[model samples]
Target: MTEMEWEGEFDPMSDPEEQRHLLSVLDSFRSYRRLAHFNGTHVRRQAFYSLPQEHWTLLSKPPFSVLDSFSKLDDLIDCNAELAEAIFKAGFRAFLAPTLDSDWVASVVPKKYADDDFRTYSIIMDNMKVQTSQNDMEKARSCINQFYREWSAEGAVERSKCFEPVLVALQHEFDMRKEADPGLDRSAVHVLAPGAGLGRLVFDICRAGFSVEGNEISYHELMASSLILNHTENVGQFKIAPFALSCSNHLSRTDQFQEFQIPDVHPSSELADAIGSKVPAHERMSMATGDFCVLYSQHEHKHEFDAVATVFFIDTAPNVIRYIETVRNCLKPDGIWINLGPLLWHHISRKEDDEREDKSRGRRDVVDAGISDPGSVELTNNEVIALVEHLGFVIITQKFNAFESGYMSNPRSMLQSSYRPAFWIARRKPSSS
Candidate 1:
């Protein structure tokens, strides 16, 4: 069987649904200005307008006038608009660039070219359109905050707490393997990072001299990561006020308006520097965009990876057992599987139709097939380990409350939330003949 590279870019003609989804995501970015204007500006201003006339007089004069505050918000909204434009353009370029092929060109060519079997095409961004929804706008806003967690220097502390242990474990395993096999090549140490949202961990693994691939299923994540991983050229190249939209949990207005520079490290330059000439940085790291189970369970992928690293990912399954089975099937004999994150169980409350939508997006669940109901088998940490053993894995390392980390948290917000997640490393047992 031929190995499928799985670049994750869907062909527009063949996969119209995915194309529509991509366009909708792009439209969300494009609608940022309108949404921000209505939600941020208009709503807040209306509250101010409702105040008594005497109170208005007090807010109008003084060290900081109400108009002055509104001016600052307007400016912040403009900055967000600029960032949204960049995101939309980057996503457009990344997703559509691959479609400039002979077949695609022939479809849009002139009559003469069509008759002669010649091909010509021009990609017009204006011609492609999609309407944005309230849901899309909300996700777009969330995606902006994700940049803080994934790329900003201010988020390094949280990322270090969550990612450092996984990195150390992988490196230690690599060192032990090198000691056992003196001729082992770092390039041959293949690692797979499933549900690699925004790809910070994947970049770290590749920098540690291991060939890595990141897999993600969210269009929001995939589009944003494409811009950062592929198009970014410099450190701190973009600035964003991630907390600008939040109206609560602020000790000071300065905290609310705080701006952060994104991509603390330039992905391409840093990866190139670390990997050197042994393998091109691009070849050392890649991203596969699809469901983890479906993509990795294929014949060509069986026994294909030396290690699989999952961070804040596994709990997304409706049937976590299927996830365990897929991990076992994809790993070579005695291959390692490292996991970190709490048992949040994303699909616990999802309706049947929601489960079907997930399956359509490549996520498989027993609930959709009538084999189980939502949250039917939510397991405790020990039960999860027991299930891992039952599915042909031997626990190598396990820990509870491994680390405290925040996801997309605002440092200045008065309310702070965190997760004290479980961490483990398991080895797939050799198959019995």
Candidate 2:
């Protein structure tokens, strides 16, 4: 185990290598701190379930308190080998098994790329350190801002089961509408996938025979997704090395280098062949980069889409009501909106009185003048659902589920993170005739 030490400050103008090292080291220390917090928080939550066959060997045959005979020389010098082994096995079962499970999710790096793995691993591993200094919030901000986009893109899954609800609901709606009017044009069905990262979901929707446009706000993701969608030949086969920590639950050591394939939109030729359509996938699909709330206000896009789909995106906005209103404007009457994501809001908040003042007067002025404002406070899931209904959206289908979802999550940690995602399908109410 690496000795715990204090974090040191670094010059902002340092070389890229040094800067990378500084950030990685600080992140390692942060991870250690987060793990410590997790342990402390979960100490009392015991799992009463039966252990699997592998862990059966760890239980003691009989229990006896060694401290009862502490005065005896043998008792003081005794080595309880079985107890030590049991503890080690339990730690391994929780923290180490997940890394192996990760390998099953995606292919591992080949032997030829072993050098590449070690090269990347060395860079991250060499910087691990015990942080003893006072917390630095600015450093945390810098690290997250620099790497979060890349991490998100690399972690996208090939076919996320989380998307099943949206797909199934959409297909049912499409079939129902078609049956009602047999002459309806299938090719004219359009979908708007906002906050789409790397265009995987959009691509899949297009494959299902809908004209899809993906909208993203982050330039980092836009650039990376574009590279995968338009430029790469075998786009879905793209891969990257993500983690650098070793399997021993120690930041000081390095895990064996492994690469995982990142999910991307299918190549244009393949999609065209599968869809049997004259329009290619590139033509059937497009990406627009901008704040989604303002995207349609300038273009001839109002009430244009047949449906809107958002996965892991509604929570990105500070005020989700704005998103709901935007969806109302972007969809035709009775147009569907399918959303799947946790309601955990990511934006920071301000005093309610100040928010009202800005809304009553200066908010529009600030936006028109391109002056940025602090994001709106997050709303609970129930609040957002009620807001959608108040905005004239009739809820069609609503389902709730809890599961783990994310890219590049550390496989060594058994602290598998999960969220309660709300799968909602709603439609815009037609105007009163």
Candidate 3:
């Protein structure tokens, strides 16, 4: 969310818990960059050396050119290193300096996190020696890959398949409302998008003449998205080799090292062009950084949104019933609720539950947020719809197997996975039954 207001001048470092969290996030980025170098050079070289000498000699010829492959891999590593550096710099800036300076920071960030003193604190964090786990490196790598999914030209096809339908449904809703009430203003339509990773769908909704707020809980995602949304000045301003670290499922070496320009379209410029001087783009778009249930379930948010649109988001909940209830609370009477996603429940697996527990262990904010449920209740697509219908929603339109889509997929990879997500538009009843 935009910077919140504080009752007094707050000091972020005063809170030991917040200080630790901030340092941990910064260290994760640093470790990610360091691991990229190790993986790109030392690990690959060791693997090359492990091969039989005779086979290496034979493969060193024109057909295989083992040495040449090493050189190419090195070059790819350099590209990835550059991308990692950019990610670190951007993430650091977003964490320390948000768009609007306020005494109170976003929920995930410490209060008064943007103070100039934090820059000095960042240096201390950089100098501190901390052990980085494999899991941290993997999470950092996934954050980089998300850039490819949300902001690159290559990701547009997937976005179109997944995001377009939601936009269309919203537009239809807006049109119907305007037709029924001739004096309705387009700018009055406010939409809440939960699990809004990188905010591509939120940006699309803003472009379609609606005020939209994107809610995200992951600091990794919020940091990266803030860079793209608020900091990016031009299209193709940044380039990243998202697939560089993946050594498997490659049809060709080129595919593994492919580079993609971020922000296929510059956010501000596109918004300005689509929405002229009548209303400023910044006022229409915002982000809320916290758990969706915690933030939206507050009484102030009740009946505050005209519509709630979810894209590949519902499955992340530990309890889908709470999600539905939160949605119901957020909407006005006869408000629209649009959902598109698969039934891949994020908390179903024991491994995922363990990860969640580990991440939430020492954080009081997380524990107090009421999200520490042990496991999720997995439901079939039809069962999910039945729950929605039973929870005081009238299905307006729904299509099962709406379309097949991919998430952060590499088009040139030898192996690709897809999901056949369900799509539905439902309206909240005047009151719960």
What is candidate 1's lDDT per residue for 1-433, written digit by digit as tens? 1111327633533566556666777778877877898888788888887899888778878764866777787788777776676777776656765665655554555556443311121223334535765666777888887888888898898888788888888888878998999887677788999998888898888888888998987777777787777777689888888888887888877888998898899887787688423766667787897767766766778998999999998888777887887788788888899999999887776666545544444323322332233344688888899999988999999888756788888866899998999999998899810
Please give the lDDT score at residue 296 for candidate 2: 49
The best candidate by lDDT is: 1
Using lDDT, rank the candidates from best to worst: 1, 3, 2
Kindly report which residue stretches of model 1 are placed more than 4 angstroms away from their true locations once superposed: 1-6, 9-13, 97-129, 275-277, 349-376
Clashes (backbone N, CA, C under 3 Å), per candidate, total 0, 1, 3
List, residue by residue over 326-394, the lDDT tens digit for candidate 2.
888889899999988887665444345324423332224225311023456668778888999999899
* Per-residue error (Å), model 3, residue 332: 1.2
lDDT (tens digit, per residue) of candidate 3 on 212-249: 88887665566667677777778988777887777789
lDDT of each: 0.75, 0.51, 0.72
The positional error of residue 322 in candidate 1, measured at the CA in angstroms, is 1.7
Q: After superposition, how far is residue 187 of candidate 3 from its true place, in Å?
A: 1.6
